[model samples]
Target: MACQVQLILAIFAALLAALPFLSLNSFPIRRLLYPTCRCFPGEPCWPSDESWDAFNKTLGGKLIKTVPIGAVCHTNQSFVPYDAAACAELQAHWNEADTHVSSPSSITAPFFADQSCDPFAPPSSPCSIGTYVQYTVRAAGASDYRATIEFAKSNNIRLTIRNSAHDYFGKVTGAGAIAIWTHHLKDINVFDYASKHYTGKAAKVGAGVSMSEISQALKQQGLLAVIGNAPTVGVAGGYTQGAGHGMIASRHGLAADQVLEWEVVTAGGELLTASPSKNQDLYWALSGGGGGTYGIVLSMTVKAHPDEPTATAFLQFNSEGISTDLFYETIATYLHNTLAITDAGVGSIFQLSSAYFAVVPILGLGKTKEKIDELVQPTIDALTSKNIPFSYESTQYNSFHDAYAATTVETPVAFGQLGGRLPPRSDIEFSTTSFTGALRTIAEKGGLISGLSFNVSRMPDVPNSVLPGWRRSTISLVTGLIWNNTDWNANLEAQRIISEEFIPEIDRVSQQAPSSYMNEAAAREPNWKSVFFGDNYPELLRIKKKYDPSGLFWARTAVGSDTWVEGSDKRLCRT
Candidate 1:
């Protein structure tokens, strides 16, 4: 009788232990009966298997597959379904979370970087209730593009296109939705160069091609294009959308300014070409309308320049004895002289430090010290006159491509997979401030100064072609602060205080300045629409509404969020 009682107790404990799993699978009866799960508000509601099957058939090919909603919710890493066992394991993990049952057909999965920790959707906050759905699509080529857009419209699903996934604001991918990964659309086509009105030699490149690949291709052709310093940044998507500027921008203008034409898929699902001649409205919009706002760009035809001999100089200066006033005066003089030499096709970037400053000036000249000096001397003279202690070195290369390859630091792409690596170890935060002469006083007061400024004077003189907020001036200056202390909260607070206090001071000086470069604009600004688009905001809004009538693309700091009201020109957050 004792042995029998012990056996009965053991059986009862085992049964009790299994109860949670049983209820987990059965309480949400939808999970057992349906193949997909949808979450509304907070609960997991299951969708019928038949609906999922029907949706899969519409995707053509085996490209669209279903995974248990439970599998996705629990995994911390990027969830790419490769097999059933993995899917089951993922589902079991996901079952522990508050997930809804929804068919994969109607769902769009958000692609995340490897180290991301934020829940895919924004919490219910003062702004809007973020949505999370579970369908993902990787579309490439013309046919896939059409099908993807059509399916999205038919199902009222939200879609986001991701290539290198390098967007700083997490705009490239999202949660609980379909993601159209375009990394496979890597094609480089050199059309009839002369027919495209190429005075020298230019090429039409696909959206998926990266700067590194394009740089190599152009090198083979003895040609070069204005590309960003980072090799991994996508040429068509990154460069075109951000109004890409580079070391050569002062000589050739912005990457977008060189665009001859662009093949884009509009909100209406039509593949169309835009240029100065065709779809003029879109041409203006795409020039610097910011990414994924108007439409998906398929390809771009941009101006190319012949490879020319070039020289690069690197100078370092210790700000040890420099007063804040002296530093500001010196910088002001440097800007004045730099602008005066704009016609010489001289471009220089100054990286400041709290205790030091590094200047990398690229001169478009032959491999001769005299030519290089002639290009760089004015700004160098200003620094020397200020009695600023500094060291200088120079090197000449066969071409600008070679010079860039040798001098420009390569930013690591994999770091992006690690929760978007923090900006260089500087105390500065980006701000959209017009440069005025306030630096003279700041320099006298011994304030810290560090940042970069690029001259875009060589950009083609296209009417209304400047960046929206940049209409006030010919030269744009980017100034920042460097914090030497590691008090995280205090440093952050200092950065905010510096940005808020000083940027407005600078902008007050350069009241008539050019538009802010979208790449450098503060992500916290509420009036980013006016700050980025300038006069083009109304048109962008119209196009956005046309393509995303349901406003599915709305996300934090995205192109079409309501936070960017028309004329709210004040900074949004303090930190």
Candidate 2:
């Protein structure tokens, strides 16, 4: 026994000696290596008094101050003052629970209102008004949903289901509201694999699943599906509402187009499912009417593709000595070439900046770069003949997820540390104009253009699926200036110039295209309804009225909030 103990001690000492090297090798591991807090382990975590005070001020009296009945509570005054008693209780409960629980990571810190604003604000924005809250929910299946609904109803509070907090219109979370962060609702279940309903296979994904997680899961199952980059964006929210586009759009269709069914909670507190055979109207509305305007989605059942061959190409172009005339010529030629290649199951996306340009093209349905080259070589030759300096690289993947991640660029937060500045504070404003005909003329005249194109091959084959107003045009383009300084007047002047002077110049040359992608929209569009929702406007408004009669879901740019609505809009009654 003495000899065995000595040997064990020697091995332990050796492992300890290697600890520093392991830490150095795995920096990400360090981020997850925080010491456990003192709060009761199994109970819900609570904010310190200082944290709560800061959060209360930021909310400006929007939250309920008292704890609800049967809910655990704690009061620590700062990050340093963790409630040991609360942590202990929670830890004990967690150990006894049969289900799996994610160990708290550093990324799960207090979410402050000020933190939200900071990312949305321009440079040097104030942080004094920022506040945060920390909350936790126990792990359960259907029972968890019952508890959540009951909690909200009993507390007289509204719940905002947030997965990634990546809502472009800011509907995922709100100031001073109790945020039910759903990132913990990570469950992925593969349903029937031979059902005609899904055209083969489908998966029911929990609301909190991220795009990256879904992609990895599908890959493991020898299947693929449409998803965006920015690994952290929620699958149910972003993909569901924005009509998700991907590299394979020319062949497969938008993300919403492929959804087989959805499980959602209406504003009236009813949990429902939307699909072709059930609640079809709700299914249509939820597809592209923009999320939060109808109901909160709990899970989504999406169509999946069997293992299939895919091809991708990345081409880079430098504008060093290229004249504005030549640049415009290149863009026109590229668009024309893209339209020509669609028949061959080909689609391309052009990413342009003031200094450089990159084009990503995808060929679906078991095609190859060699075949892609057969169709695209002419366009490539044309650009090269004009002395345009460019390079191209192409490869093939076994699935759609791999092809998408290879082509999609990471999205920078509009106002976060990643993107330089935030949206302006004063009356938030935006402008847009459409283009047509004279693509070359505008380019030669030095019109700045930033364009993105996706072939909508897999979109629902139904006629009315792509809203009427937006269907007239095939390509969508946006060009604008982001103002960072606090000179409100100057920023306004710049905005006017872009809207009236710059965009009109392009419109004059190209004629008026008259359509835009609702997801990448400008707030100042005169006929936003006709532009974004197209023929679906009336239907969306009806559903909005039915589900949210009180108009409690409206935020900065949420659907159905008539910028013109008088004081009739107010929070929903928790009764």
Candidate 3:
């Protein structure tokens, strides 16, 4: 007993002596203790059940504890019991965008989802929420938005705003955060819009309104609004705020150019209207400043144009009978005429692979079938000259909606990495060799190339914070590197190739400074400030500070995101 008491006293003395030297800044101690981060799950600061229950009551019982849809595949999960039938259904639709969009916590980009609860994994494999938001508030109105922002801010919880979850950069999901799911806020109203800036027909759409829904609604009213090329993208969310482009962008302008007013709930929980005449800075920033940065958007009233006749065409060719050099030459010829086609009031989207090239649709607004044929004849001639066998089709529709429905390829949710660049007209017209050579280099590297070519310069100039590169830019080229879901090394290599290989090749010949569509860009983009927002970044940052002083909203590569760093544990903390 005496010996044991002496040993205990000696250990206590040693600990007390070492306590003087112990420091919070020392090695692993700093990381393990006193981490200045947002409250994470299992932490004492995390909200209690009583607090959550009270908050749910405040939201009118809208709060939902996240249960990953994949839970249906795993029997071990306590929150969800496995069901064989439901698991089969989920596995079938795992790759579809709607499967994720319709869910409260799922995002289209699985890479960001951390593969936490993959439905296709072994049925016995454990299922956890992983990086998905822990709680979601299905926000239906301004009150819900206000309550969510206030609660997240007060609780020091990371807040994510998700509508449709069609984000490519994982902007719609965050770990240890609570989300305001605006998916059910599907309100649409069409009216004769009159504003101080101008007067015209317009539609007020909810944040959750998808492009397909708005198009169908407006088509019935004999009007149309500039929407995303993809049918599932939300109009008033990231699509428009990131300066949405569509088939008719050359004729009408980007979706940002069409905006007349925005109804948003600020970080202070004050609902405000942003337009040219009121809250002008917020209006300017929100138009193209990137979503989930400024505030939670309730709805947007945008200018709608009268429905018009449109012509659509499709062209497809491959390298079956042609030499590699000849195939590239044919592609080069078509790419060189991008400016001319857009100048003639036509826009087009095409897919290019090492062995295949297909222009799914060429949009000719206010033009006839013959006009579209004339515009595409040069490309057809190129293929003919090379003796390349191909197929071409053309059709004229009474409305843009009809043409869009026929030609718009249903974009599936791809689990891959995407790197993008906006090659200006000057480069395509002058440095033709270098421009096409870069694309060939990327394709040769097993990268799939997707191109959207148009002239935003042709649109009515509306001052917004969209990438200035869009003004002079003729094409937005995205290079995709897909990898198997189970292979971590392959995924890392794919991302590395896009960040280190594909983008640099294009930059060599790109006339403008490095710029890309923020919504569809590299995960590890360098100098994102200038690349995504350009000279407008400084002003955008100022507006972000003014509206969201607490940094209540954040996303990957968003405005002022540099102010914080996501920790090793995925808890966002001040750098």
Top model number, lDDT: 3
Q: What are the Cα lDDT values of the candidates?
A: 0.53, 0.52, 0.86
Sort the candidates on lDDT, descending order: 3, 1, 2
Residues 403-501, candidate 3, lDDT per residue (tens digit)? 989877558885667989888888889888888889899999899999998888854545788888898888878998885666767888888889999
Candidate 1, overall lDDT? 0.53
The TM-scores of all predictions, comma-separated, are: 0.69, 0.68, 0.93
By descending TM-score, how would the candidates be arranged? 3, 1, 2
Clashes of 1: 33
Candidate 2 lDDT over residue span 1-575, tens digit each: 98986786566456646776543113233222211211211122223456446544444433334221101222312222234465455434431211111221111111213232222233233332122222323223344444554444333333445556554334443332344455656899876654435466788898888888888888889876777545666778745665665555556767788788888777666788888777877787888677666766778888877757777777777668998656655655665666556546555666555566667554554677677776677668878899898888788876666676676654533321100001111101111112223333333433344454555533364322344422333344655454432344554554565555554554453323344555554434556566566667887788777776755454434567573221212222222
Model 3: colliding residue pairs: none
